[model samples]
Target chain A: MFLFFLSSGMFLGWSLGANDASNVFGTAVGSRMLRFRTAAILCCVFVILGSVISGAGATHTLGKLGAVNAVAGAFVVAFSAAMSVYLMTLARYPVSTSQAIVGAIIGWNLFSGSPTDSNALSKIIITWIVCPILSGIIAVISYKVVSVFILKRKIHMFRLDEMTRYGLVLMGAFGAFALGANNIANVVGVFLPVSPFGYIELFGDFCVSPAQQLFFLGSLAISVGVITYSKRVMDTVGSGIFKLSPVMALVAVWAHSVVLFLFASQRLEQLLLDLGLPTLPLVPVSSSQAIVGAVVGMGLLKGRHNIRWRTVGGIAGSWVTTPIFACLISFICLFILQNVFQQTVYLP
Target chain B: MAFISIFKNRTGIESEIDSFLNLASESGLIFMQGIDAYLLNNLDSFSEHLSHIVETEKEADTLRRSIEDLLYRKTLIPESRGDVLELIERMDALLGRFKGVMFRIEIERPNINSQFHTGLKSLSNCVIEAVESATLSLRSYFKDISQASDHIHKVAFWETEADKASTSLQKAIFNNNELGLDLKMQLRDLVRSIDKIADHAEDLADTLAIYVIKRSL
Candidate 1:
């Protein structure tokens, strides 16, 4: 029964992997700088490592937004979010798994008569708005610096091509790890409170917590999605949306990885606090949004006419609609799971 | 280990491209020597220069094929591969034209009057300079795109000089009443043939300018 309930979260994980892995490796693969197999293998290994090592920070934030204490309720929340994402994808609008999962958790809080922590809700919302803007700024600066360096160096064209290939591979690895660390919460955060797994003792004093184990499972599902289903999406995003040269592609991936790392790295947060500086809130921000922001930043740097405003407007519209759809689906589904199936959805 | 191999291959390919361009320039020099020897009635030197150019063209063709193979096999420069390949092939065709004109002179062995020798030599010199400028522009395109425009404009300059030399030589041939119409026409054809090499070089220079612009970061 626990496995049955965890399947929904795994499905959500799979969906996230299928869609978001493209943000990291799409341009590399699409531009033929890196093969799809090479990218998928690196992405899978690094994503799992990231989820198990640093996934707790974002999950903690999601837990604050709403703690669904029942395993069945967690299943319903994940399922609703996945359904909304699927529907949105079918409608051909850009969707963010982070947004859908957040809205679904709030729906569970409302259904269970648990007050959603307004502070956590506000922080998460604000982070969503700030994530893309920060990514764009980083991308613009990085692109300018790299362009100037290449020009000043007067590197041979073939040498530059080889260097860009290696850069894409390295940045793709970082982007995959950051994606796992940041977005794993959207896959299994709701299940943390009602986890059925036990902690594992490693070496003499080392231990793997239950949350880590749950995250490992979710990340494995994501890895499977990457290996099996991400190639087509990577190809599409790499070539269709924005025609990026390999250098621009590297900049976009670098900016996306750095933004995800900033939002998800607990060590960075602690270091900022120790330095008496304000820390960014740890949250699951959309990889797709970060990539899009980076691409747009590069386009803007080149010229305003380079951007397709209609595509940007359509993506922004989906951001508003995805969460609302997930919320409604979660509320109705939770009602059926509770009364119709005769299950207790909340301790209260 | 893989990265080291890429580095080694990159250096090898870079030098190979340099050698190929050098061969193109070398062939132009040999073509000018062959034309000068023919006008001076030095059959032995003319034949020697012709064989040297023929060998140079063969060497360039072989080098070009190897470079194209390496580029495609290794998948380097995915974005600019087509442009680079086109540039190399067009330059090779230009070298072939040099060889073709040399062969024409070898076969026709036109009896050139001493009075026309200076005009023919001057025209050949101008055409070779235009080709040399085109080669320099191509080299700059690979090493420093900023310097490419500097060499590209010079190709046009040399091409105009060649046009002036060819026009004056044709006028000299047509004005000489001692020469038959057939001989005048033959000499005019030779002059135009040499002039056309410069025209081809100018066209390549224009294409390279566009490629340099495309290559800018």
Candidate 2:
């Protein structure tokens, strides 16, 4: 019964990998600089490593947003988020796992008659709008710095190409790692409330906790999605950020990584707080938003001609609607699962 | 659908640019043949080769336009798209010069003294060599960029030889009593025109060199 409830979490994880992972390496693969197979392999390795190592921090913030203690409640929440992602994908919108997970949490709260923490909810919402804007600002600065340093250096064309290729691979690895660290909360956050497996000693000294087991399984599902479905998404990603020079693409990815790491890294947050500096909120920010922001920043810096405003309008519209759609869907699904299906959704 | 098409999966745009280079090279071959027949006073063969050169130029033009369209329409390799476009346009201009020189030679049909035949033929060979070298350098830019400079230097060398050959031919035309003063000037213009073909080729080769450097560093 416990294993059965994990299905929805895995499904959500797969969807996150399928969509978000595409944005992670889309420019490199779509440009034919890096092959799809190579990008996918790198994504899988770094994303999994990121999930297992740095995944714990963001889950606490998600838990504070809403704790659906019942396994059945968690299942419905994951399912609702997955449905939202799928719907967004079909419409060709930039799907955000952070939006989906947060929406699902709100739905769980409303359905279980638990009070939603207004302060936590506000922080998440603010980050959603700020994340992309921050990404754009960082991208503009990075592009300017790199353009002055590398592009204007008058280096030989062949040498510039080799260097850009290497830079893309390095930024790609870092982006994948940042993505796994920040966004794994969208996969295994709900499952933390009612993890099925306790500590199991595989070797004499090696043991794993219930949360680790769930996260590892969730990470595997994300990997499967990257291996199977992310290719199509990656191709589309190339066209979204047009007129990007090699250095510009690298700057965009680097900006995105910085935004994600700032939000997701608990050690950084702790260091800030200890140094008498304000700590950034350890929230699971949207990778899609960050990357889009970076692209927009670069585009805007170049000129208005660089961006297709019609496309930008459409993507922005989708971002506004996704959370609302996901919240309503999850609420409706939880009500039906608890009342109509006679399943326990919330626990005392 | 348009958006999806823009993101359509494809391999290196360098290969597409290569196909255009190949077409340009074919027309270069046609240009060389037309001049060879022109020098031999074989009107029939010259006409045949000239017509073929014209046809190849038209085809090359069409290919170049199509490549430009594809580059603008698709978002593949946004980084290098501009460089590739510039390269093709330069090569396309060289093809036009090829056709122009051939057309001028056919219309004028200057009666050359056999004594100057060796100089003219040697000059024509040098021009062809420059064009060939330019095409080779561009090819190597795609396949093996490290080898690109070696081919580019050859283009420069042949261009220099062509300059010397044309200038020597001009001096000889003036010294000979067999040709009238007015005829000598006309023949001199023809020699200069032939040298321009090589000049155009060298210009393209120089552009390719800059592009190679831009991509590498």
Candidate 3:
């Protein structure tokens, strides 16, 4: 039973890698700043680093979302979420693994009679709404600031040019690192609860003990996903929406990272919410959404005419529909899998 | 008496020709470096420099063609002959783009609406670094190519930076409304072309580095 959950987590991690890694470096590749090979290699390295170093908080949130004691339930949720993301990716739609997983967990909770944590759900929903919008706004402002102040001066053209070039490289590198740090949990957080990391394991008799091991496996799976399946989606996302200039790409990425960090910061989210402001919890919202919002925001700052409404509409439609569709499919799958497998598959 | 005087004058003139050749060779390096600086700083003023460089490069091309003809007549060049010819051709093409990019900069100059100045500058600097490295490598007279490799890496670093700047610049451009839509599109295209110059330079540097490394190995 434990093995089933662990395997399901690995599949979820693979699907996450396939979908999310594209978000991290797609712009760079799309803009031809980095080659596909280079981006893939970088994604692999930084994602693993992100998973190992900064993946803990999200893992805990996922583990506590619902009861994981019923191994079959955990497996069903994991499998459903993975399949949803996979099918979406196959259809060339940029769906959010974070959203799918949360929805799946919610579906399971509904059937299990576990009271839904409205607070958690609200926070998650708020993040989903705000992250992209905020990221877009920040990208616009940052671009305006940098262009107006620093790039205009003509003091030693060669020296200034050199400085600007170096600065951009550093910025991209930082963005990549932040992406890894903030997103690792979304890929592998589910397995943290069932695994035995504490001195006395929570699921003592369960086969996979230590949540950290699950994270490690999850990270490995993500790496594999990044290497094998990320390119197709990366190519699609990188080139689909709009043609990006190097600076715009940087701004978009920077904005996405900043928003991810903001949501990922529990302390910050609480402070904002405490101030009577609508705040999003550190739920992993779609990086794709955050980037598109940032890109569009930057465009709006340019003017409404510059915004590609058609592309934006398409993306919005996907965001609105993907999770619900995934949930329904997973719910149906769960029913079917149970009926077919009968006693072989235990449903809690 | 007239024949003897003409003969003597011709001999004196022949002796002075070497000094002129030597002067031309020394001044050629200065001219190339000046062209690099002009392209890097005053990209908006590209046409003027491009014409001059194009004329000079044509002269070099003629000289190279003549040399090739002579080498072919003399018998096939030795073992390194193929490489030498290829190198010379590449060097000429590199100079040609310097001319072409300058012309392009001029053509795109009117659209320079201040938004892309930073990205343009960074890209120009990357080219300058690459050219400077190539110049240094050629003139060092020593066989050490590490110096050249170090400089090429710097160029690559700058190209990466240029890419970042362009992304931001484009974003800003997209946000700006004062510029007409046509002008904006033109500016975007121009910036892309300029960025490609750095990319080309980086390619050159990478190739040179590989050659140097392989030779060392």
Q: Who wins the lDDT comparison?
A: 1
* Winning candidate number (DockQ): 1
Candidate 2 per-residue lDDT over residues B1-217, each given as its tens digit? 5223323323334445667778777877787777777778888998998888788778878878777776666544456768777877888888888788778877887888888888988888898889888888977776666677898999899999999999999999998987899889888988898899889888888888887776552
Ranked by lDDT, the better of candidates 1 and 3 is: 1
What are the per-residue Cα lDDT tens digits for candidate 1 across A210-251? 999999999999999789877766765676556678898888
Better of 1 and 2 by lDDT: 1
Q: What is the DockQ of each candidate?
A: 0.73, 0.11, 0.02
Which tens-of-lDDT digit does each residue in B20-87 have in candidate 3? 22322433343345444554565534444455666767776775675455334422212223444554
Model 3 segments more than 4 A misplaced: A1-4, A60-65, A154-187, A192-212, A267-282, A303-308, A343-348, B1-55, B58-217
lDDT of 1 by residue, B1-217 (tens): 8678778879889999999999999998899888888877899999999999999999999999999998898888877888999999989999999999999888998888999888888888888999899999999888888899999999999999999999999999999999999999998998899899999999999999998887777
Compared to the true structure, candidate 2 yields what TM-score? 0.69
Clashes of each: 0, 12, 16
Model 1 bad stretches (over 4 Å):
A53-61, A87-94, A189-214, A264-282
Report the lDDT tens digits of candidate 3 across residue range A223-323: 78778888777765566666565556667777877777776778887899789997655566677778777777876776677566786787677777666
> Which is the better candidate, 1 or 3, if ranked by TM-score?
1
lDDT of each residue in A135-155, candidate 2, tens digit only: 999888887777666534544
